[model samples]
Target: MRRNTTFLSAAALAVTLALPVQAQDAPDAATVLARVGEAEITLGHALALREQLPEQFLSVPDTTLFPAIVEQLIEQELLHQHKADDLTRRQRSMLDNEVRNFTANAALSEVAIAAASDEAIAAAYEAFAAEFGQGEPETEYNAAHILVQSEAEIEEVAAELDGGRPFDEVARERSIDGSAQSGGDLGWFGEGVMIPAFEAAVMELEPGEVSPPIETQFGWHIVRLIDRRDAQVPPLEEVREDLSGEIQREAARAFVEELRAAAEVENLATDMDPSILGQRELLDD
Candidate 1:
């Protein structure tokens, strides 16, 4: 099916193929190639459309592509001009959204392309590494806990802990939770298990230190940070894509802020009935 389409594209491009416009012999872009009613499609239009062609169409010979592009532009113009001037309110709204989306994306692309220079990425990596403990592998902890149904039970466990009972021993005897059997060992998890109240409490404790009683939905927890080990952080090259996106986002945010600071803006709809947004018939007119 695609082969036939390719053949057709090549044929369309070749229609003007009486002579292939080699790089040296290229005609002026302003030269008109065809007419539809009163509108002229020029060589410039064909060349520009060819630049935007999808990869599959590009593989076709320039001879084939030239005619195909011309055909495509002519057909598109005909369809566009055939449509009445009276676009529906909904259509105009959608077209406005598309235009905004394209322009905003193009602006962001420009920022992203310019921001990811080698020096910029290197700088970003340095900052990132510093924030990430200066390239020290992040630490993952092995922990054990005694979970009990009440504050009273937790205090008992704390007393036993303070009295020098081993955490795993205490866990074996006092923890009603499953890990109690394993001395509450949650083996290893990385950062984007990112954060949580339970994890926060865990992080604050030095290995072998017992936490003050922590209350959670499960019950009271007497947690011990048993041991911790370093977890790998990817090298800069490995995470270049992620860092590039971050750079792009940061640049985009700064650009938007500059625009906001320079522009005069007003919002007059604050008191209006937001429910009116649901009225579909409003667009019918």
Candidate 2:
């Protein structure tokens, strides 16, 4: 069956976001998905690669995308197979440093993630739910607004609205925000994501109702509630990647803390003026 590009895109993002570091030795390509020659390419690896590809490349049809990536991988493997050994001292040193950094980062990430436990993740989820006021999920607005720095501009826009002029037209004419490009499409967002003042203004308006004007740090906004819906708790399957990262980060911190408690660490000076370094004259000798 052909892979679902959109679903794969989301999955690819999840994998990348969940695990930012790449392991030196990954699952063999043939065993995981399909392979090209001696080089193994797994589905996970493909997905990871697809995530990192440029946006324009991502838009290319998968039929073309797949073969192209295979060819690219084969070329890389071919180069690896016949890499020249001759190198200047500086070149070798640079190579050594690059390899060392890559290995260290990958190994540390693995250790951090592995240290996480099921209980810890569960606790974190519960805490997050509680913080969001885990009451019955309410309707969330996916609205947009044209922001202006002055009340006069806000009133002028309001007048245009009163005169039956399309809000989008006025938005394009006067909005100072980046949203002006798309006629102020802020896209889907839930409560707590926006500033309190903005949220309050949005909450007061009924769906399809446009507000007169509201002020916030960004400036005055004339918001239109484009759409609203009863927000649902995303299934664990939907948000597993984010949860995994959170668990990994917490585990890493806890592990580091435990080690710190068991180790002997001391600061050489209780207090030292950094300016003292400016007076150093021994190096002149």
Candidate 3:
């Protein structure tokens, strides 16, 4: 579903807002641009509306955005003046929810922005480095396989290996798998990359050792172990983006928990039939 749907269509405004824009000194948002009857539409209204737009629409040039946004505000004002007092209960409830959601998000955005400051990021990175460095070096496996339709086909493939035919050579000649073109070589992978049955088979084999026919949902299989190595811990700069995300989440959660502790929130629907939530007619004014 579309996110944060607005009164004006994003696609419609995109075309209208695409007119050429030249650079110029910016004006104050409070500057009045239009009067819808007695109601004034200011640059602030246009700017706020533009800010409310989805990210995909934000790249539209501002000079082009000004007239179109003012026009939209005038239209909105005309509509509201015509019948805003006549809004049905559903429309009013939806508008209330939209305002609540937008304002709450604005508040949480402040917390997240503060949480991801340079000092916070540095502290988070230090903790991550300590915890990450404490773990045993991770192991990786390089393996290959021949996938076949049934037990008989896999056995025939395995028997060819017993006769000293190269695994890759037999794979190309008889294997139905896609990797047959590359000598059935599934290249380097870390632990947990393969399905459980396949991974279990690989771990039991050393380099150059091929397995007996193993069954999985796709069909039967035999895996050959190729090589193994340990993965190194990545440097801080490489993982900074992820670290900052974790910092933001932790701070938001802590702030929310603190608020919850001091609040008197309670659910009043404890005894209501949950299925009543689907009765759309109940929303009628």
TM-scores for the candidates: 0.56, 0.49, 0.69
lDDT for 38 in candidate 1 is 94
lDDT per residue for candidate 3 within 15-123, as digits (tens), equals 4442233333785866677777888777787777787777775676766565566667777788888878888999888878878887778777899989898898888
The runs of at least 3 residues in candidate 2 whose Cα sits more than 4 Å from the true structure, single-residue gaps closed, are 1-107, 113-139, 235-241, 261-285
Candidate 3 local accuracy as lDDT? 0.79
Instruction: Name the best candidate (by TM-score).
Output: 3
lDDT of 1 by residue, 1-285 (tens): 011122234445557643333354566888777778999888887776766666776777776666667687777778768874767898788767877887888887888789878888889888887777755577788777789999999999899988988888888888888887787786776655723767888899898788999888889997778778886555999778888888888988998888889999898999999999999898886
For residue 184, give model 2's deviation from the true position in Å: 1.9
State candidate 2's TM-score. 0.49
Q: Between candidates 1 and 3, which one is better according to lDDT?
A: 3
Give the lDDT of residue 265 in candidate 1: 82
lDDT of 2 by residue, 1-53 (tens): 11222222432322321222235475444334434466565556566667667
Best by lDDT: 3
**Model 1 regions lying over 4 Å from their true place:** 1-24, 27-32, 42-44, 47-63, 134-137, 140-229
Return the lDDT, model 1, position 123. 90
